[model samples]
Target: MNSFDSSIETYLSNLHFGHLATRSIASIADLYTFKGLVLIPVLWWMWFQHDERREWRREMVFATLFSGLAALVVGRLLTHWLPFRVRPVYNAELHLQFAGSDLNDALLSNWSSFPSDHAMLWMAVATGIFLVSRRIGVLAILYTALFICLPRAYLGFHYPTDLLVGAAVGIVIAYVMTRDAIRVRYATPALRWIERHPAPSGMLAFVLCLELVTQFDELRTLASSVVRNL
Candidate 1:
């Protein structure tokens, strides 16, 4: 597995170019990896536009958001419990392909590189969305693959297997969350509460927006601090 990962990384690193076009692709790729930022607005629009299926849309939005949170939690747990894995660019021996000056070394160095949180979150949300609307779900899947997963791999942020396993975990969790029994037993009640209490829900959304802007680094730091203190 090490050899396979290294060989693929080598191939990709060799393909890196210093062209404006390549940098543009990498920039877009970085932008889309934050699934919450891009998808939340889309989900909001969908929730509002489909008046006929407003109830269903509400459920879908909640499911996707919940599943994404689950993915982040699970991914963080895996990173904590599992052996520390260095990212490709940080591996001193490996020659990683990166757009010069565009790569943020500090950001790349801070996190473990096992199961990709980005892949997991987006895949979970994509699968959850699919449960509600097939057409949009299909589009989400394509976007995840093309714009999200591939770019991460190409940019040496993750090994292909890291993405594969993260995506698989996300899909399974999302599928389970969207099950009829689960939805009836849990989601329905949660949605009812939110509907009854819009103010609190709005406040939560505002907090979430701030967290997204910071890329949840504060939350991660808080979690780490708690673990260390414990």
Candidate 2:
């Protein structure tokens, strides 16, 4: 077998065994689901419950949420168009073997496999949350890494490379957006627009634009090559 085929074989071996072990662990899915449900409310309590941060707390809260969503959507679409990859269950082609999951159904698989949305989204959220409060951010990332991302690989929803790349994308997006948010905090025009519009509008516009950019064949080929190298 060629190198690519060999890689797939390795993935399959790891995945089959991994799932058997994963079932034994207290479900990572449950941990992530609970975290997702409580993430926002908990963050709110952290920000406002502190009597000391009365003024700056609200601003920081808005920045973190707005920047996190923007990063997730932008990062997800940018990575999707690159090198269309077949997911695990659809391995009829025998091109690449992926981890198969018993927990999250293979039927939920979408196009492309190089970057995982869950990884990116959670990483982005954790990153933004971290920028606002070091204590909270550290906990969020720890929870995400332990529960959300590791389970994805254990269940075969994504490859190790996919998770790593998705995380890098998330971090970059979060850093960039957060930096911009900081600038906007000081800029009069930006502050005015942000106050006038809801938090979702900027993020929504970014997602639409990302969709358009990924449609071009020239850019798609460029992205495919980049991901292949990674």
TM-scores of the models, in the given order? 0.84, 0.63
Ten-residue segment with the worst summed lDDT in candidate 2? 208-217
Residue 87 of candidate 1: its Cα lDDT? 77
Q: Could you give candidate 2's per-residue lDDT for residues 1-230 as a string of tens digits?
A: 24653474566535544555656442554443444544555545654565765445555555555555665566556656577665544545544444443454533454666677666766776787787778988988888787777766555555667777777777776677667456355433543565589577467545533432232324656886898899
| Model 2 TM-score relative to the real fold | 0.63
Error of 1 at 88 (Å): 1.0
> Which of the numbered candidates is closest to the native, going by highest lDDT?
1
Per-residue error for 88 in candidate 2, Å, reads: 3.6
lDDT of 1 by residue, 107-152 (tens): 5677788998878878888887777779988988888878878777
